[model samples]
Target: MTETDTLRERVAVELTRARERTLTLADAVDDHDLVRQHSPLMSPLVWDVAHVGNQEELWLVRDVGRREPVRADIDTMYDAFQHPRADRPALPLLDPTEARAYIRTVRDKALDVLGAEPLAGRRLTTDGFVFGLIVQHEQQHDETMLATHQLRTGPAVLDAPPPPAPDVPVDDRAEVVVPAGAFTMGTSVEPWALDNERPGHTVDLPAYAIDAVPVTNRRYAEFVADGGYDEPRWWTADGWAHRREAGLTMPMHWHGDGTATRFGRRTDLPPDEPVLHVCWYEAAAFAAWAGRRLPTEAEWEKAARWDPATGRSRRYPWGDDDPTARHANLGQRHLRPARVGAYPLGVSPLGVHQLVGDVWEWTATEFTGYPGFTVFPYREYSEVFFDRGYRVLRGGSFGTDPVACRGTFRNWDWPVRRQIFAGFRTARDVA
Candidate 1:
């Protein structure tokens, strides 16, 4: 097939895959739950479902295809910036049944546009970037919905087999030494790289050692037992304030015992699985208690992507190839993180393991644009979030889709927010 035809097919598959995930999550819950706000941090499940379709229609059917607006009256209702997530349920949202139909209609029109619209010419059309943006956006919302499921208090609704055990026994306490050097930090040539990750830049750093795997539940429990939370010295002023206000003694969903809740069911926390639901403040405090610091954003990327032998950065920890089941736990394949060294094949050249998927690892760096950043299509996507209010989290979680997560992919949130599946690994300066 011609490159155009190939691109169109790929886009179609991605759109389908994303929609399937969105629907599956929506179906898992009843209408009452779908329209219900499970957590203040997340929008109602139905709102997320319809919002993805609205975005698809706005970007693809309206902007790219030059078609009349589909459901323009509800545009304000679905406009994320217009209405905060807390107020979405109060709006006249399309019910679950209507939402499914709306997305189906929008996807049909979007696919039609894909078949006819030339894949090249304008910057947005070039490399089918807009379609990619939509796919990523939908996948991100699906993850958000999954987080809502985790937060909802009720009988278990979602289920998935545990992640595969480690291929080879791994030393959970081991660290990988990344030597001081310069490496390309962002993607300029990657066809669908988002604007925030654009304009590849070089970052230099001194030698440091990062955890070989994420800090596991076992290690974190040690911190908790040692009064890591009670001790104010480990926490920064802001973190200490938030910790006290939020009463964050342990990871979210965790109980006083060694068990934690997952998908509305309480189970023994896996000793080796990376700790989840940790906010930036908790991660920073854990690092301080451990006598190590969270890896800077550059440090995380370099450890995950930079290949010292080749003097180049790879698209993922393993290589430029897309992820498969053997790579890392992603795409909601497993609802929770894998054991620390589960994906031996997914390890980076420097032996850093599970960097791409498992948990969104909190970094020491604040969210900001790279050198020579430029807004594309719209500024709301990334630029609006560029202020220093957010902290950067590298690596995508098990809930992340391959389309949305990459070595350079950036995820950020308020430092005090802990509802999402976030975790951390520690790093230290060379002695």
Candidate 2:
């Protein structure tokens, strides 16, 4: 039909899919399971689910001209910041059925209004921002819920393997060599990227040879076999200390038998599959053992996206369509890491495999602000992580929201913490 009709249809589909995702998540756990908190900081599943629904109402109905769907008490039940995790036990409980109903009602109202309106050119302002944020927020909850279930429930149900990678023809050695040049990094136009990727700036990168594909399990296995973990020479002093403290011998999900198994599902570590679950130290050691280094954040960004005109500043590696399954492993049905090299089209201009998904690739640059960098109006996102030590990780993982998987999206984890879905690729400065 018309463009407006098309937009409405897409919105309807998104709402329906979100509702289905919520239902699936709710059904996966029992009421008893919902009450239990997996971590001291994380909210209980029931509260989290309700919070997702409540967010929809707050943004769409209250903020977007639609009528409020519930009593004001609903706010008190789901304000996460107001009702901290510590206070969850003391807060009034919401029956699971009632909470689900409220969520469904909010979704239904949003669908109705969106379908009726002609919103093609209408610039989304505050309420629209909330709508997008809530959708992504729910997706994040979906991932966290799965992680919580894994932690709380025994591995029996939680340990199913991620689905097989979609059969895309892969040429294992198809490499893209990037000639070095100066480029502007980060997002110029702010749509929905987090504060960390904001206030795009320029960066110069030297000519470097980066692997066409992420380091594979087979490749990393060679390093491990050669005593990469035991040798301190390969690791930075800080990395060495972190490794010693954690007592890590190999990648987190890798088994003694040498197969890459995640959540208890065994898959052949295809030589072509990008190596995953590696922390920064492990990545550095692997690079050292292999005579290479991890790409600097600027170098990685340049290879991913190269702007031709100014010879500076690139937006996305694959030129910015947002990430799709055809492009990357993000937003897959399986809630775990994927085999690297699965998505060829998603490769950066430099031909790196799985740059936007499968796993987050750790970069060499420490987390710091660009020149003239200022905190966003919202403080908690990036400002808290600006200490001297933390390193940047580019490319979102399979567990990340597809909408959130922009080339500019910047994530950082402590070099020592390997529990999260993090991995790395290598880059060597040209000789």
Candidate 3:
């Protein structure tokens, strides 16, 4: 009824949604495949699923004194922060059925307890905060899983790769014009934004135009067809070296008879599907080939945040509502990149399609701190990858949790390694 009640209800709903997502993701992967070491960045799928459940229980129940049910060995098996991956493979893992059941039990217990009492006035302890962090953390891993699977299995799961755009379209044709103004950027106000998005600050921008849609598979195909991969002129030194080392000739989930195909499915190229599995180098090369460049992080936020009438920050591209299937491709059963132009309503203020959820858009800026940036108590958040080699990525992907797709959310990865749900869109400085 009241605002406090509404907030509490939202939190409860979020917890339910989080549980549902974890269960669905866990169920999607074959039990036998859960143990495979997909990549160094990825944990075994089983471990991640149990870890998510354990984290929720540890946070809301054990730490909060409701002290509801949890697996006895959870501390030993799923305590990821304390025990890293090197230690995971050797642990006595629960059987897939048991693990799923345990996860459901913990989730139900957490919901029953939290639902009874509103989370409104509850003061979260450090451990409790860690639980919240794990939720987002696990959601990120889920996205990675989808990406890794696509990379390994090809576009059999994707709807299909779209045909390349016709001549990159006119540069200004579908641009969402953002007016000049100052707006807050970052996570200062939100209680749960990642450290990188935190200490929100105001940013000033001159007028700018951003693409109304993410770069399509067809558009990127054009780049590759134009020798973007072979052209040293299109690549940075680091990018070229990465290309040479990885032997990357196309986007990660592409294959066909000398043409690009989406992962996991045989279908006609859709031309409207957003590109997926592109590394920073590929994204950059495609941009260069098209005579445009990836949007800077600030430019992206500006275009997504600008308000036409009042010029205020829009909480999300589609407004403050949480993501839904109608809004974006996230939380779907297929867990693959969707057609690019599918969610017209999800466009950012500046007309950037799929700004919130589809595939993360690679930005030109290096991952770095804003003014007054400080690390969280744990060192692994932002400080782990401040090196110049990493690039910033924005917008959450189809595999991403809705909560993790907040406009200010910041994700980073090495420019060369495109393993985890990485993709890009292009932008150019308006004349």
Query: Top TM-score: which candidate number?
Result: 1
For all predicted structures, in order, the TM-scores are 0.99, 0.80, 0.82
* Whole-structure CA lDDT of model 1: 0.93
Q: Rate the local accuracy (lDDT) of all candidates.
A: 0.93, 0.69, 0.69
Summed over model 1, clashes come to 0
Residue-level lDDT tens digits of model 1 in 281-384 = 99999999999999999999999999988999999999999999999999999889999889989999999999989899999888988999999979898899
Candidate 1 Cα RMSD (Å): 0.8
Better of 1 and 2 by lDDT: 1
The segments of candidate 1 whose C-alpha lies over 4 angstroms from its true place after superposition are: none
Preferred candidate (TM-score higher): 1 or 3: 1
RMSD of each: 0.8, 4.2, 4.4
lDDT of 2 by residue, 195-245 (tens): 677778867666787777667767788888899999999999988998898
Q: Write the per-residue lDDT of candidate 3 for residues 263-376, one digit (tens) a residue.
A: 455445455567777888888888887788888899888777666767667778888777776777665434556665666667765566778776788999899888888887
TM-score of 3: 0.82
Q: Which stretches of candidate 2 lie over 4 Å from their true place?
A: 1-12, 37-44, 57-99, 105-127, 149-177, 264-268, 307-315, 334-340, 372-377
